[model samples]
Target: MKWLEGFQKLSSVLFILTFQGANCQLAVFPIGPALVNALAGSNVTLAVSFRGAPDPVLTWFKGNLPVGTWTLNSSSPPDIADGSRDVLRIENNGSLTFKGVPKHFSGNYTVELTKSGLGQALVTFTLKIFESIQNVTLSTQPDFAQEGAERFTLQYTMLQGVVEQEIWYFNGGKLKNSTRYLIKGRSLVILEPTRTDKGSYSVLLMNPFSSVTTHRNVTVLYGPDEPIVEALPAQPFYKVGDSLVFSCQAEGFPKPTAEWVFMGQILSDFHQGVLNLTNVQTSQGGVYTCSVLNGLTEEKREKNVTLNVYGM
Candidate 1:
């Protein structure tokens, strides 16, 4: 009942984005952005400074929700003490602290101040747990590439922390939730990784409390196994109006598609597995590529060859 008196004193503070009482003005200071991101199972601490002095009440929130305990009530010169048992909320050191920020902790928060009237201010921080592991360790297999072996493998071990599962992810660009990912282990090793697999590769560790991620570079092995591409002019020279034949070959678990890339970056419709160019001219000279991609497996292989047009 007496706590209601504390609300009357906080009226001096300005309220922004009211959520409660009329006179209970709440103002969330240093509210820079509405969205944020972080890795899972990682220890993350957020720094927030509030304004409005004289009998002010403060609360801590995660994403759009609140975690642990928010202290807006201790009348004793701003000191942190226990508020509840089952629900963990801390009010100390003039700020709020949450141990090991997790996925479920992502949400919006409000610091409501209630005097005789109820007024609330909002200072929300969104936590998006990343895939970086703080304790566990990760390593890739078959360190060296044999030029064209087209094999890239990565393995991981958790030195500390609890790991529910580990996943290997490969991407040519930015990694997304929809990006291709595989459950990698001793039994499940990475497939043939060609030059294309040299992009960003990362590992994710999933757990109930937190999630972590690690990144590594994938190297292509040399084995002359690259899709061998040969264009016309197999001889010393060639003439115009001549038939240009381009063939691409590669070896891997699943076969890859080989295509011809023209000057316009267009595909010459390959019907019945044959790429034929009719009446080839000097302008048709450019980089021809054989690209094999299976959207399902997220595996792709490509080889390039230059066509030289000469006047015979």
Candidate 2:
């Protein structure tokens, strides 16, 4: 009876050792990238390698939900026929591939591998799908602005996934936030824009997958300012035989037109904002007026000057 009890214990130990050896025979390891970054409207593959006799059963799951199944049969090759969705495919090496990946496809995936004599092995992966920006557009709130305007807003819009970063540029140089410039969400505001603000502006929109840019040209319009009239000698007194030249200029957009006026008569001989006199006389010492006109703004400005000629 003692010998029989000992033999029974030995048999149980042998059986346990055989079971552990069979379980250790099957080995599985992930072969490809653990994180898959796929672009929208593209294809991606998640792969794995297995070593054991008699092909193992491969099952793919996404967030605890079964997505696909593959069973290797000796008679025929394994295919994606058992996939739950048409976009999913199971390759011969027990890899899962997705075609035409979309934004919603980004998530965690798990591959459950099982063999007849081995414990199940699980391989995990993280998938990220990114969409590129498209149909980008840039515009200003008021297309046209006058000098000393309160403010103006530039709006940017695009069609794409979430934007990770946004950069603004003016005339090929990066723009920084200043007291007069404010950057808001998808908009740029300029306080009291003047003629100096006229230039080409661009915005760069970027995501993890790709980046896009848009450009716009802005022009700030102003009116004709006070005209400046000056004499060639820069002094009010000149000799009778001395030549005198009077010039008029103003600061304005669209270039202000100037007309010279003496007393109540317009000087037709001096048309281009300049009046030249060969011989100065006491009779021409009266007040001379320079009138500037801005046709676009329909605004007029003028300046007056007095010249005194002395006999030599």
The candidate scoring highest on lDDT is: 2
lDDT of 1 by residue, 49-136 (tens): 5444434555454443434433545655433234323223344433444455555555554444333233545555554554534565
Cα lDDT of candidate 2 equals: 0.81
| Residues 166-249, model 2: lDDT tens digits | 898889988778987888899888889989889999999887788888999988878688888888877759887888889999
Clashing pairs in 2: none
Relative to the unseen true structure, what is the C-alpha lDDT of residue 37 in candidate 1, on a scale of 0 to 100? Answer: 57
